[model samples]
Target: MTATSTTAPIRIGVMGAHSTGKTLLLQRIEMTLRGYGIPVNRTGQLGKRAALVPLPKMQHHTVASTEWVLAQGIADEIAAAARPGPEPIQVVLADRAAWDALAYWHAAQEWRQETPHRHDRERLLVLAATQAPKYHLLLATALDPDIPVDSRHAYDTRYRTLVDQHTHRLLAAEGIEHHRVTSDPDSQARAVDRAVKLCLKEAVV
Candidate 1:
């Protein structure tokens, strides 16, 4: 890996509900960034790896599960920024972020009719926004009418949609800077390219 030109590596998050093409987009964007000789660390689906119960078997996970995944995601992002190599990682492409985890926690609570645990919510929000190395650009994959949702997630359309809605609501409430990438795959990749370029430009300035 090559060292990054900047002291802090640039972070970019690709976020959306399950099967919204976030992983594919993250891979493509990472490839593009690397072509420019940017040292990159691409993280994919932290929740899947961190969750105690396999995602396919669970409708909703416990708060401890959510917190565990959140902590793992934050730790990975921080470590990527601080990693030692020939070059600092210039770009860190994340499949989803801490905010996404928090959103899922909110959605799960709603589904179970559990009360709002304000402290947990606040803790996550603060860590995602402040303690964690924030994403310079967060690319959100919107659910477009033309693109059908992948059925592998048990095809619970209502649940998936609810999670998506909650994710959007949390993003808005936290005032995170993000752009929705919609349309076809080519357009989505282009959107990511543009966002990354803009972020790099700003980093230069």
Candidate 2:
């Protein structure tokens, strides 16, 4: 069923570099919200999905792939918000968000030293920014190189670092308000607490 204007799901988005705990953080928030009897829909793994489109990812990301990722993410969030069920969804946890694609695209361009088409970059940035106002809360993770990533997935450390840097840079440039999450336990706890409180508050409203 489509949600009414007053009952639209509150969206919480998390974006950052690979293996920087974006998924784990959202999982924690989702579990906690469910414990409180709040229904949440989370959109994730767009990177893997994009790759299936045979779209270039990581350092090979192109404007087309980046645009696809951003568009798909927006569509996912829209679907989550209007999900049909016995109990309407109260929260949408966007794992990568739209801006996350822009970060990877920017990093890829920098990594390959490719000259970006200014108009294309502008269009992508504008597309990403359109969703900024929809997010009730935005969280960005800071990369801690000291923490070892899962060996199962081969990740380029340099490109990962660049993504992290561009993620923050873009957030700051857009003046988007977001909580910065780190690898520290206390930091993680605080981020989780903030999300829980926000979701709980929204539920009551």
Top model number, TM-score? 2
Report lDDT (CA) for all predictions: 0.68, 0.89
For each candidate, what TM-score against the reference? 0.82, 0.95
Per-residue CA lDDT of candidate 1, range 1-205, in tens?
A: 1123334567777666777778877777777767766678877657667544554212375667677777777778877777789876767776777677777777777777787678876776676665334666677777654567655656566656667788788778766667777758677967777756854664432
lDDT of model 1 at position 155? 54
Residue-level lDDT tens digits of model 2 in 1-205: 1122324588889999999999999999999999998988999889889889788999999999999999999999999878888788999999998789999999999999887999998999999888877888888999999998889989988899999999999889887788999999999999999999988876853
Q: What is the lDDT of candidate 1?
A: 0.68
C-alpha RMSD of each candidate structure in angstroms = 4.3, 3.2
Supply the global lDDT for candidate 2.
0.89
RMSD versus native structure for model 1: 4.3
Candidate 1 lowest-lDDT run of ten: 1-10
Worst 10 residues of 2 by lDDT: 1-10
